[model samples]
Target: MGNTSVVLRNVSKQFHRKTSGPLTALSDVNLEIAPGEIYALVGPSGCGKSTILNLVAGFDHPTGGSVTVDGQPVSRPGPDRGVVFQEHGLFPWLTAMDNVRFGLDVRKIPDSAEKAQYFLRAVGLAGFEKHYPRELSGGMRQRVALARVLANGPSVILMDEPFGALDAQTRLSMQELLLDVWTEFRPTILFITHDVDEAIFVADRIGVMTTRPGRIMTELRSALPRPRTYHDLASAEFGRLKEQILMSIREVIAAKTE
Candidate 1:
């Protein structure tokens, strides 16, 4: 799929429950992700990071404003956009290759096996094709999950805390793998994460959000250089960006507490 741009304009979302009145998940949240750019959103929990992703993913609708992709309004989920949650979201009964093949099969796309296998290899899971989710480790399962998303060839990939559950080392490895995959496939990405370091490491630009009535507080364009490596994690610019994001988060939390 060719790269495409995503735009969220004055987006706001409110959820109403019978007993709790109305809760505002987002308020006047505006965001733009350039074609093929990796944009990460970092915010305190319940700050609507996932809410923003959901809106763009067409899983939910905003109460106000518009969500568009390639200048067209997003009304429902489409093949042009793909989403990967923190959970692998793979079928336990399906083999790695089968899970990757599922979407293509549903869409009636031809050459499904070939494409699925190719992506599995791309994610470093070449020989594990027949293994079920239960047979694999956490990191391996995630690799399969990622391969599934890429196999579909979406122009935009929306990730919600995709690496949050992995151990630190595995998480780092997946981060590197994601960059490698991005470099080759070049999909516009909106990544949601709570880890400051992770946000700085993976994003081309990182957006930090304010408390409760979530909205972007600031956005930092990363300069640590790409085809990112663990070595970049120690660079001064990385540390500087990390600290800036952390301070912003702290301030948001502090304000919430107050």
Candidate 2:
């Protein structure tokens, strides 16, 4: 594609350690996501999956190279990029609609309340608008969190294990719901997850990373067709991709252990 939505060129990030020299988190990592494409990153713990996410979200700066979205360098978090962390990060006292409305209100978006309601409905939380975060189930709270992001109408949606906390069944439903939202809004998504199946389920391409000083070991393009269902998870092609990713991850970990 001539125009890329999210781009990271030779990106590297390091953090100063208390007792040692700088700790490298990522090294010379490069990734490009086309507009409306869903890209996923999967790797072992401490492999800098979240580090890559934070870089693009503009929550942190890289030590070298560049991070850009929509052809512009990212210096700080902006409304153009929406992020959903593993935790729902909702206000405990706020109702679902209010939680979704919070961002719109912060941006001073016109008709904030109405936009919040519409997004809540879009995420299948129509009747739960009045439910407080404490009153809602884990899945519902996550739905509200997702609605809040969608309401912002971001060009790039950055997610770090957004559904990793849910139970198996709830997580499946949420995965399906995510696909529906992606189809409707078509925001370029950068998803970071520990689950290989989840990555295959939601991503157009998946990058597997090494254990430390995280670098992409390989990238796999999803061959499974979209509007994907759990039934598709049983297909030979899905199993093949999952097997390939798992094998790659295992090899990396095994090499480190050896």
lDDT of each: 0.92, 0.93
lDDT of 2: 0.93
**1-258 in candidate 2: lDDT tens per residue?**
358999999999999988988899999998899999999999899999999999999999999999989899999999999999889999998889889989888878899999999999999988888999999889988899999999998999999999989999999999999999999999999999999999999999999999889989899999889889899889998999999999999999999999
The residue-by-residue lDDT of candidate 1 on 1-258, one tens digit each, is 124499989999999989979999899998888999999999888899999999998999999999999888999999889898899999999999999999999989999999999999999999999999999999999999999989888899999999989999999999999999999999999999988888898899999999879999999999988778888988999989988988888998898889
Pick the TM-score winner. Answer: 2
Model 2, TM vs. native? 0.98
lDDT, model 1: 0.92
lDDT of 1 at 138: 95
Backbone collisions counted per model: 0, 0
lDDT, residue 106, candidate 1 = 96
Taking every candidate in turn, the Cα RMSD to the unseen true structure, in Å, is 1.8, 1.0
